[model samples]
Target chain A: MTSDLIAGTPAATGEGPQEMRSRSELTAKEVLREVGSVLRMSEKEASELTSSPVENDEEQTMIINMGPQHPSTHGVLRLMLELQGEKVLRCKPIIGYLHTGMEKQAEELSYMQGGTNVTRMDYVSPLNNELVFSLAVEKLLGIDGDIPERATWMRMLLSELNRMSSHLLFMATNGMDMGAVSMMIYGWREREEVLRFFQKVTGLRMNHNFIRPGGLAADLPAGWRDDVLTILEGLPPRLAEYDILMTNQPIWRERLQGVGVITAEEAVALGTSGPILRSTGVAWDLRRDLPYLKYKEVEFDVIVGSYGDSFDRYAIRLNEIRESMKIVYQILDKMPSGDYRIQDKKVTPPPRARIDESMEALIHHFKIFTEGFKVPEGEVYVGIESPRGEIGCYIVSDGSPKPYRLHMRAPSFVNIQALPHMMRDGLIADAVAVISSIDPVLGEVDR
Target chain B: MSDAVVDSPAPAEQLYGCVVTYSRGEKVIHASRGNYIATLKKAIDDSFTMCTDLTAVDFLIYASTNRQLPSDISGERFEIVLNLISLERRERLRLRVQIAEGEATLPTAFDLFPGTEAMEREVFDMFGIEFEGHPDPSRILMPEDWEGHPLRKDFSVGRIPVQFKGAPS
Candidate 1:
């Protein structure tokens, strides 16, 4: 019973998630103890507890700390929410819990080490972030993505797979937050399959660091194709199961529909991006509209909603999962193999053995490794379509190995700005719906 | 702040050994500061506005390389980058103008684009680049009592100023 409150389970299952066991092992005892301190008090109760009044319920306003520890807040983020009973009056989101100073830290690192730095920004869609940063740098160098047809396809394929995983995680957690018990079970199961695809291709489930400056880290492993195809093939039926279990369900509809509705003008003003912006009747998809990579070759639809409500956000995510899956299927069919890295060894390091044999290779490797290749001094902003929204990297190279300034316009960070606007004078329960609907990752927000 | 920019980066046809690169999600115009805005307007104006960015990068390297370094070097002076984001095109254009290290007087873009009000103030606070005509040109990020521009490449990133944070370093 205590664990259920701690995990926010609406109904009890025989066994908790297996990942929760691993989490218990990884987290420090102090962190777990701190979480326990909060689990002892209900968020609903805490909001009511803060009111300075007699035991009269109507006059008191409650202030609740909605995480930096709780599961549903997504990463280490705390929202100081003011509640007049169950309806939220105001919400002030406190950030910087995950302030790694990734931009400042990137300056200390050379160009080649950029992947290791930026891949952690959007931890869920690491490859997409890595790709955007790399492309911006490469563009500065006047280099194109001339690696291989297959590598580009692989980049697209993995991005779509990652999108599915990201959206599935959102679905699972959003469902759990809204008391849709079975949806969590189904969503997590589907997400696990996508993670398995990442594990096989990049050897890391979350942060692959596979996409690099010139090309991929290396060629895909043998039989990797089969593994991804299997997942893409299996996703549609599972997505349909989710629709039946959650989307079409009347109770799910009631909680989400017409809740926290934002207009297209409001979304633009607040800097909201991704599906949240699209849900507001805006058809601004970076892939179709902006056209990055081989996205021009691949065919897909930009899912838009008439109303920018929680329900529309949910619907867009589902439609995107299907669209992304469709693209993944096409990538598998059209993937052409020739070269993974650029033929110019100056831009890319040679095969591992070339360092031992070739003097030119040795010198090139040393210079590339240490001094790092210089980008011409100028600036270009490349807005790449991430699983979320416009993940753009505006790069200014002073013709140096390290970027002079590294700034990320993260979708989650900008989208989170809309939170207070949507939640003001709304139900306290609606705050969770608004946040979960935004699907923000604190890593990206505070980065 | 109000500024008059004569942005000229050589003759239009003479594309010299200039290699343009983008960095850190900020666009730096990497040309000589003489007539920099006039030239960028010719290049980026019709298709996209060369809106300056949150902060500017003073190419101390380029200034030194070209033997164009300012005589009176102060902590405040650096290059100003125009961070232009296109609403219609959904694109961005970065234009730059270098001011002397000590003297932060440069042409303001508010005359060209009105949305640059917040952006110019940010550059003033972060890099101490004074926009001559920027209305309400004051520190936006740091406190009024704060010393020196915070985002310059020369500005050290370590150590806390006790007076700023209410703690002794």
Candidate 2:
């Protein structure tokens, strides 16, 4: 029964995306298939066989495999490294182990179904993925400027909260990768608070498909204002404590400072973004630089650093968490009240009462479920200040329910390009430190 | 002049019949600056600091022109889009330029905005849109052997089947 059911399913049975995603959801058959793909290094073995070894040399280069399971990679990322003594002569990030084909999957689903696909791409910060995709689709639908102001503001609030939680995981994991296991305890504890806020709003912790095309799933519930305020109020003191515990520590400073530096030019050319790019003194936060939502009305600073190194990335992230805290505070102080999602029934389903009373409302609902709303023939690019960086989605709607072209400009994917440049000419010890600092969530990268 | 191509068409004549439209298909403003992305960028760059996003729209059925722009970047191309955002104004603008494929190669935003470096690479990666002087010209996303630009209108949605093992192996 299970095998037949799995066969009936679409791409979930595919031998990819198991790397970043938990394999528990997959049956034993699925895992075996993915493992086969992982070990299918046909080209590698052929190249290795053709190469001649140093017959009488005093030294030899060693090739190594680093994770799809290793901890330091942040997700199920595998690295092929050629080590000359302690120096890495070359490194290739073997991705697609977590290949969800999110962009492809999104094309099969309607615009309404798109949130489910996007939320899984950058699983850590699903709200961001949802927001950019929805905004782009809505732009294609020509309802972008028509969203209720309150929806836009709340979207910003939740997205900022998402950033805080994601960064806390980074804080925890970076600590663990560096052997500061105690810091992991602190990081998860802090991240849990942000997750609590997420749960209060969206009902799910990790993969909330709450933010959808046209607007959000539901309006801010009762006591959400108080809950958000409390979370915001509580963050600053913890940030200061984390600062003292991590940043000011002499050992932490040494482990991080001046390690894995990428210059501004190189970062841009290689597509490094988020804290990694800001660490080079760019001050180019998408919220400030390219205002979205009510971000223009809110007051915040673009956190920047002088050295584009691991220490700088670490510091910028810490400061950004605090900055996100400030934005949440502002949202509480000035959030407008109205319908959360747009009132456009063509894109958004009408109120439940209308569904019961009006035949047209029932028809709209059925059509939305079956055929989905058709976006006009056009293309749009919408980006947001994801914790990782400028998480943008470029959508092309060819008068179809499914997007013609759906490509995500995942910040983690772009930022990972700088890894080879930063990891070069550095000791093996710096590898973990450098990778941790970039805070790449490969769930997004492979998607 | 191998690298340079020019048409001596009268700028006034080209600008004569151009129309511009915005939200809900309303013409917010219209003015023609002949046929270069630079002209559009110049008209707006004074307000918008960043040429943040650039991509093309394949108006398969909607576009009046039956002639499709060639997917190749080196050839002259149109049916293109350039999105501009102003950090100061808190506004975003999208500029459209519909040119034939061989007439492609819109002016580079690399000079107007430094951030176009990666975006141009993405355009090249998916749509095969090339920036003539792009600093590094290599595939940004797909493997080297990947046959076609996935974002092109013609690429089909291919499927992959799955299988798995449960317990730790």
- The per-model DockQ list reads 0.07, 0.07
Q: Which stretches of candidate 2 lie over 4 Å from their true place?
A: A1-61, B1-169
The candidate maximizing lDDT is 2
Clash number for each model: 36, 22
RMSD of each: 13.2, 11.2
TM-score of chain A of 1: 0.84
lDDT of 1: 0.68
Superposed by TM-score, candidate 2 places the C-alpha of residue A281 at a distance from the truth, in angstroms, of 0.9
**Residue by residue across A117-147, what tens digits does model 2's lDDT show?**
8899888899999999888887778788999
- Evaluated on CA atoms against the true complex, candidate 2 attains a DockQ of 0.07
User: Please, what are the lDDT tens digits per residue for candidate 1 over residues A271-291?
Assistant: 456898799887878788667
